[model samples]
Target: MADDEGLSNEVNLQQRHRKERKELQAQVQKLKHSIPKGDKRKKKEITEQIVKLEAELDQKQEKELEELESTTNEPSKVAEQLESLTTVDSDDVDVAHKVKENKPSRAQKRRDKKAQEEKEREKRIQEETINNLMGSRNVESETIKAILDKKGLQLFEIASDGNCLYNAICHQLQQQGTEASNDSLRKQTADYMRAHQDDFLPFLTKDNGDIYTSEDFEKYCVELEKRPVWGGQLEVKALSHVLHKSVEIVQAEGSSLIIGEEGKHCDSPLCIVYHRHAYGLGEHYNSVQPKSEETVDEFT
Candidate 1:
């Protein structure tokens, strides 16, 4: 066995099975003999023992037979011992019972659901704010891009404090600007970021995400006034246009006579084009109503 790598190990298993069979047979015979022909107590003990031994014997026989038919060299002496773990007889499961026992109680479930809903509502608001910022016309692309590229604790720092880029740019254009100061400028930037958290954070993600200009940020702030709706589904751009006085309109969806002049796309093509400038004349950020659907007139 030490020298041969591919040895057929069968005799060992056969011997083990034979030994077990003999032991069980001996035990069964002893129990059968021990029971006094008319003694009730001794007969009960013998009967219980006989039942146990018979079950064991049946199990051993099945295992030994399976081993004899094996081809993959699995050990036959320790054949798999399988047993029914549960005594459940029915097919239908009592969901309500399981829910009562395994799941959260009614009050706990309500609390959990409330927490989840609140979280989702906050998230939706954040999403809408970001979209409004992206769509706003007040801010510039380069300014937003530079802010987003800034990394590390600097983001938090700026958010808490603010940036002086706008001020610096203004000063430079006036020809009264000096070199950008490290400490002072960073502090200013941090202050600005902190002041405009809702505007900036919504558009910012370290990875590929929305980034908006100062105008967009302001627009979002305006929308915060008389904000409509249950949650924030509308993006910051739409919010800024309506809530904040930002972005101009090139064309708008004028009313049509078709279908009783319903709305845009009712009896016309999408002719609405808001101006791409800050301070749009009459942009309103009201709740976006669900579009009305139409039905075909059927006749026999």
Candidate 2:
């Protein structure tokens, strides 16, 4: 009975100890709640430990993924290399599906046609400028023909549009890339200007600010010893809005054959280029007007 009593006392003591431990745990939880969370160094250390454990878990997952990929298909690695080196094969049987036909469409053709038309218009303007310049110089057909031949501009081409003699010839030379000397062009241009200065020829405006007319320019032409040669023409259009005002010549008629109007332009018989020579009129001749009556009396 005493032993039994002793066992009961021991059991009671154990139950009390357990109760005390429970109370101590409650007090410990209350104390933890009373302390500020981020203020304590030990709390920071516990958070760091938790983060470290999570990182370790993430590493384990990645290692599993890598292992799985390594155990899978043999071509997985080689597929990347093959894709890098591969080009679409034109000859392969099924490649027709992947091939793209690059022929221009109807719309593209229309655009090209419009572009071609614009180019043709610009080229036409350039040709007209050259013609106008030639016209002003009174350059003759033969001289012009000679220069054209020298420039390798003797050929003709059939244009889908109607072609001009000048355009056809220049086009042929341009296609052949003929070597035309600038000096020749200039010299020929000048020679023509001087020879026909009397015919109210157009000139590149001379140093003097004067304009000449087609008829009255004969007085100046009388001074030229050589017949004029026609060189190609050049039109001086202003880089800006104004266009085609200036003409250029290497030599001028007389001091200047610029014929702004016709005064002495009709003074020619053999030379219809001018109306009449100043010497052509009997009014100016010593035989006709007789210089002066005083000189006539002295002679008598």
Candidate 3:
């Protein structure tokens, strides 16, 4: 019953958000058409309304999706009871046979369709997250693409399903003849952060400038170890320290920052490029591959 309710709620929320967004868009267009172009105050008011509506819609969609995803693993309570009843050793053979009857063919089809929809929904959510995070920085995709080309580097794309950063780092390591996995990296990072709290605590402040307490920091480390949180600068620093490797991030509009303990412990550097709005308005991570000097040695 819970899962059914979750699916129903997800569908309703999606429809509501889409309808509301269209209504807001229509209102904005109507206001624009009615107002004189010279009326700066009226134009500003309309612009503000549009921004507010967009933000509200975005928040609603994100929250609904989160709630839907949380309940996805829960089977309906009725199904569990029915499943338990199937195990009974009843004397009535005919009733047992009926219980053993195959499910309707359409049921399987419905399940398949639901699974596909869930996959697509998750993909859309991830794309939205990337877009929102990168959009805040005013990063441009074309600028980053040009910069990579100028640097003679190619991008090896990673899946943008919340593990792009870890996958990108793994790809970079693999290119250098090393093997790594996302889980291992997450564990190592969390361990490093927990072991050296003082080193990172001074910089862990909320948006309002309140410093994170030790307990809060520990909870964050636990989440990092267990949750699929998108890796950021903090993770980069932690991973660098744990692996004793220098990680270089090439950004579109900012100077590259090197993270790690720079000393004899550092070996070859791993390079990853960050793109803004290049992959469907989302921020993404990709391994930076440079051209080899001895290409065409075999004389094709």
Candidate 4:
């Protein structure tokens, strides 16, 4: 009787485990399709979660199979015990069977329902967040593209590394018959900022809202020159003066910003798009280029 009960428990446990595994597999599928393409960071996070769940499933399955096998091996002993226990009361047998079934009581069922609801709510929230992020990027990209279309220009995508701003500027310069390396641009911008500290120092503030000291400014310049730090409006203004060209920042909304327009060093400006939410990591920039014949035809 004990052997039979042990086998039954093992079978029930395996069934529960299978159900859990199936649910996990469904979650993995949902996650795989939840986000848009080009979101490498989010995809990586989901992949890690899927790997963890699969590992857990494999471990549980192995242990359950071993337990089930051990319980199944004593069939002959179970048969003898069953024959001897035939004289037991039918009502007692029914009660024993009910106990072995291990059905959840009302309290457990309520708790389980509440937990499942909470899990579902969390999943919904995750899906919504990803959708919102992707939607915002799509809208912003489209808006910027519309503006570029008026000028016969389109977005030239740049890598999302910290050097996107410098890379974009280099791409524009190269298109204009000026080949400048990103490293050189960074150094030039830093040097320009260092030389004109008064022009930039007033705009910079510490964490406590105090003006940056000379030492703080030096460290900032070093970070720009040696590190892959992201460049912002300050760096853009410095680059405009360094490159002797007005830098125009196009955006999805509001009027475009033209830096160093007073310099009037060139007939045309170096155009770049500024994205606030296009990339999940943070702000990004892409070069604006004139459309080629093939691209123009496709757009038409």
Candidate 5:
């Protein structure tokens, strides 16, 4: 009787495990289908969750099956006792068949194959994207380096933080005997933009593609002043005006920009290199220095 009770409890536990696993599998499928298109970051996060859940379910099922097998090693004795005590029905025979037939159904096999193909396809696309990006970056870096070499200049490495643009500008300023901190420069840039709202507001836009309202402009300035927000062409223009100096951005290709060309200090403009793929994150900037100024400890 005790052996029968133990076997029954084990069967019930297995059934519960199967039900929970089915529910989790259904949830994973739903999450996959509901993933937002073109949102790579969100998609990656969801994919991680799905992978974690699948791993946990597989591990739990394996543990439960191992335990069940260990406890039922004397299956012959249990079967003889059950036969002597109770009349086994067709349901018992069906359960025995299910336990023996551990292989997945044809439908499940097809689903697994489809899932594997999709996973491979995604992996291939990701690899190709990375390869293309790396190839493009290498070409750009070589082109920029050759151009800089011809001009007797080289890249001075800058930190890849959001404040890279401001830091690059500060480096140039410091080289020219003008000491300025990144925080001070950010404040000055924001102040210039705020004071010249008419000049900057038209160029800025809201998320919905509308021109920035006065409130939006104020909020932008506040964020720029207080946050480590990335500076772009708009900020470059404002900073040029604030510093009373021209800002020249040299790029790998195309015509480089020369902001504030009419400034009094245009002769010795602040020179910085713009890289579309210098960093994995996104756009980056580095100050330009004379090749002769390169030091042993300085990162180029």
Candidate 6:
């Protein structure tokens, strides 16, 4: 029986090794195409890489097969090891086995997502602390506040999650009885950036302040839509261009910065106040609301 099991294991190992070898051969063929024609150095380098990969795979297959053969040679030893592991309470063993069996890919994804969110929450708290130590508090100049008050605009705060900019825009749209979500806003922003790459790409830079390449720009747009990346002035500008709505940013210090063609957009614009440092935390966005006396329902 031990000999039969060992033979079966050897057969399975051979099949796996064959599959791996075929894959490596295909990879080598692809690499051959990429090597520069008439360049001996490039060809030699690619050939070396292919040989090294094939050798490694062969060595790994041999080692695994040898280990399996050795392990299955002594069935009594294997049984004794298994029996030792099973010596715990039967109920405990069953529960653990069931737990492992019942956990599907979706369950693992949910766990990973929850852990990521928790990490983000903790990061925000730490950032908030650092911001406080740096004396970053929500500060609006008297002039801007007076202008807003006189214009019958009230400030409605949005949560300072990474999605603050999108949430603020979505909230504005929802207030006017139009259904919108952060995902939709992000998609729109990404699409607009991609379509108008030339106009925006010049302004975008890497951390080193070098102008971003076309490929880098596309990658940035992709990550912007997929990840919980923080949105800033660039995102707001992109949203403005896509929505064809002038986004009036009433800042704490300077005059209001309006993004987009002033006269090309909507009649009643989408406006948000930009708090450089809001709630002693990071920069945040808040929907501009109209005062109760002057009811405004103009968000198209």
Measured by TM-score, the strongest candidate is 4
Candidate 4: stretches off by over 4 Å = 1-81, 90-142, 149-157, 279-281, 289-300
> TM-scores of all models?
0.20, 0.16, 0.49, 0.63, 0.56, 0.50
Q: Give, for candidate 4, the lowest lDDT window spanning 10 residues.
A: 291-300
Q: In angstroms, give how far residue 113 of model 3 lies from its true place.
A: 31
Across 1-300, the per-residue lDDT of candidate 6 in tens digits comes to 656776787788779888998898899999999975434457778989987997698568756865775676477976664587676898887887698678754335645775798799999999988865565352353445776887788767565556778888887777677778889899999998898898789998999999999999999999899876778888988887777777788876868888765647654467887877544446667777777734443222
**Order of models, best TM-score first:** 4, 5, 6, 3, 1, 2
Per-residue accuracy of model 2 over 1-300 as CA lDDT, tens digit each: 544654575566557656755665565565556545323345455556555654564445445444443433247545653465467554652454344235554345655875898799999999987985676333533343344344333212122111121222232233345433323333343344555454225553445766655443443333221222221222111100011112211121222122212333322111001101221111110011112222221000
Q: How many backbone clashes does candidate 2 have?
A: 18
Local distance difference test scores for all models: 0.38, 0.35, 0.73, 0.82, 0.82, 0.75
Over 1-300, each residue of candidate 5 has an lDDT whose tens digit, in order, gives 767876797889879988998899899889988875433456778999998998788667767766665666477766775576456686986687686578774345655876898899999999988887679888899888888898899888776667889989998998999988889999999999988999989999878999989999999999999987778999999889888889989898887789999877655689999999767768888888889985322221
Worst 10 residues of 2 by lDDT: 235-244
Query: Which stretches of model 3 miss by more than 4 angstroms?
Result: 1-139, 279-282, 291-300
lDDT of 4 by residue, 1-300 (tens): 666687688778868988998898899999999855545657878899888988787667666666566656567876775677699998987887688569764345655875898799999999988887679778898889899999899888886778889989988887789988878999999999999999999899998999999999999999999987889999999998988899999998798999988886755579988999888779988887787733321100
Q: What's the CA error at residue 39 for candidate 2, in Å?
A: 99
Better of 4 and 5 by TM-score: 4
TM-score of 3: 0.49
Model 4 clash tally, residue pairs: 0
Per-structure clash totals for the candidates: 23, 18, 1, 0, 0, 0
Residue 82 accuracy (lDDT) in model 5:
55
Q: lDDT for model 6, on a 0 to 1 scale?
A: 0.75
Per-residue lDDT for 1-300 in model 3, tens only?
665786788788779878987897888788778765334456667778777877687667666666666566355754675576676766554576576565433335545776798799999999998986677444565566677788887656665556678878887787789888988888898999999899888888878999999998998888888876767888888888777789988887788778874745877888887776556526667676775432221100
RMSD each, Å: 30.5, 39.2, 23.3, 8.2, 8.6, 17.9
Which residue pairs overlap in candidate 5's backbone?
Answer: none
